[model samples]
Target chain A: AQTVTQSQPEMSVQEAETVTLSCTYDTSESDYYLFWYKQPPSRQMILVIRQEAYKQQNATENRFSVNFQKAAKSFSLKISDSQLGDAAMYFCAYRRRTSYDKVIFGPGTSLSVIP
Target chain B: DAGVTQSPTHLIKTRGQQVTLRCSPKSGHDTVSWYQQALGQGPQFIFQYYEEEERQRGNFPDRFSGHQFPNYSSELNVNALLLGDSALYLCASSFWTGQGIYEQYFGPGTRLTVT
Candidate 1:
């Protein structure tokens, strides 16, 4: 069985600053996918960024990027130049590379962007 | 293109009653996955449907069943609902590339309240 862990229950960052949310997982599979999703109060889950296990280079999507340490099984999300719109509940998720594998999600970390 | 869509934004049902939630996949997406997210917790995978069949399921009970229509629309049916079943139901859609599934697009979830 695989499990995802988000150590921070809540985080806050000043607008225009930077913050990092930590995540770690346990899995036996050699190759898989890791993701960061943001859910606003509107209840829509939005994909922030994703990383492929086999890719040694970390994934980056504009202001959102991941620090994926495969050997340590740690995947963290760093938000640079944070904005008020970035305030939301962020979830760390995992999925296998297999065709139809179900996703595993960690308890979210609520982020507050201080203006 | 329109992202994934879910119906009946909110639903309130009594304990032991049954409820059904509907989802329409994003345009050109053929695979649909369902997840349950409790208050303050991350979404938990319930199942995934592809080719009108269930291809993967999580640790949920049989009371949680689903169906995928020929048009790629899907429905999640929860029978004899319990208070524990109250949560936000999220539907995600992705393209299946024969070898794997692409990044998923999520819908604004349906909030189910069992009282």
Candidate 2:
């Protein structure tokens, strides 16, 4: 079975600063995917970013990027120029790159952006 | 195009009761996946539906079942619900392009409170 781990239960960052949320996973499968999701107090879950395990280059979307070290089984999310709107609970997830697969998620890290 | 959408934003049920949740996938997406997120925890995969069939499931028990329609919409049914079943049920949708990776879109989620 595959499992995802987010070591940090909570974190804080100053506005306009950068923050990195750490995540690791244990998976025997070679072809898979990693993802980061954000859930605000409203409970609206939204996809922040995703990375392909087989790809050497990491994935980035605007100010959000992932540091994916396949050999280390680590996929951390980096949020640059953090804003108050970034305050939320972030979850790390994993899924196999098959025709159909279920996504496994880590506990989560509650992020608080201070102005 | 609308993103993923779920009905009954909030529900309260008692133990041993049955509950059904609905999900409509994003436009152009043919796959729908369900997840359960407990308080202060990340979302855990429940199952995935494609082509009106269940293609993948997590470690959940037989009491949990689901169905998909030709329109790519889906329904999740949980029978004999226990107090532990209280959680936020999420629905995610993605396009199966048979590619390396596909980004999934998530809905706001339905909060199920079992009493």
Candidate 3:
């Protein structure tokens, strides 16, 4: 069974600064997908970024990017130029390469963008 | 286009009672997946529906069941609910490619309280 882990329960970043949330996973599959999701106080879950295990290059989306280290089983998210809107609970997820597999999510890291 | 939507933003039920939650998939989406998110935790997969059939399921018990309609809408039903069942129920919609499922969009989620 695959499991996702987010070690940090809480994190804070000053406005306009950068922040990084750490994530690690255990999986037997050689190829899979990793995702970062954000949940605001409104409680809406939104996809932040995703990385494919086979891709050695990290994934970047605007201010959100991922440092995906397949050998270390680590996938960390970096948010640059952070704004107040970035304050939210961030979750790391894992999904197998199969078509119908279910996603596995970590506990989450609550990020506070300090003004 | 409309996004994924869930019914009864909030619900309250007594012990041993039964509860039903509904979900409408996003436009052009053909797969619906259900998840349970407890307070201060990440969402846990319950089950997924595709082509009106249960394509995949997580580690949840049989007490939790679901159905998918031809239009890609879905429903989650819990029987003899317990206080432990109280949580936020989420619905995610995605397009199923022949190889695998890509991005999944989530709904606001329905908060269920079992007293």
In angstroms, the error of model 2 at A90 is 0.8
- List the per-model TM-score of the A chain: 0.99, 0.98, 0.98
Lowest-sum lDDT 10-residue window in model 3 chain A: A95-104
lDDT of 1 at B88: 98
| Model 2 residue A68 lDDT score | 98
DockQ of each: 0.87, 0.78, 0.86
Q: For residues B18-108, could you state the per-residue lDDT of candidate 2 as single tens digits?
A: 9999999999999999999899998888998989988888889999999999999999999999999999999999886755467688898
Candidate 1 off by > 4 Å = B97-101
Question: Which candidate achieves the best lDDT against the true structure?
Answer: 1
CA lDDT scores, all candidates in order: 0.95, 0.92, 0.94
Tens-digit lDDT track for model 3 on B20-99?
99999999998999999999999999999999999888889899999999998999999999999999999999986665
Off by over 4 Å in 3: B97-101
Give the proportion of true interface contacts each model preserves, from 0 to 1.
Answer: 0.89, 0.84, 0.87
| Model 3: per-residue Cα lDDT at residue B85 | 99
Worst 10 residues of 1 chain A by lDDT: A94-103
- What fraction of the true Cα-Cα contacts (under 8 Å, chains A to B) does candidate 1 also have? 0.89
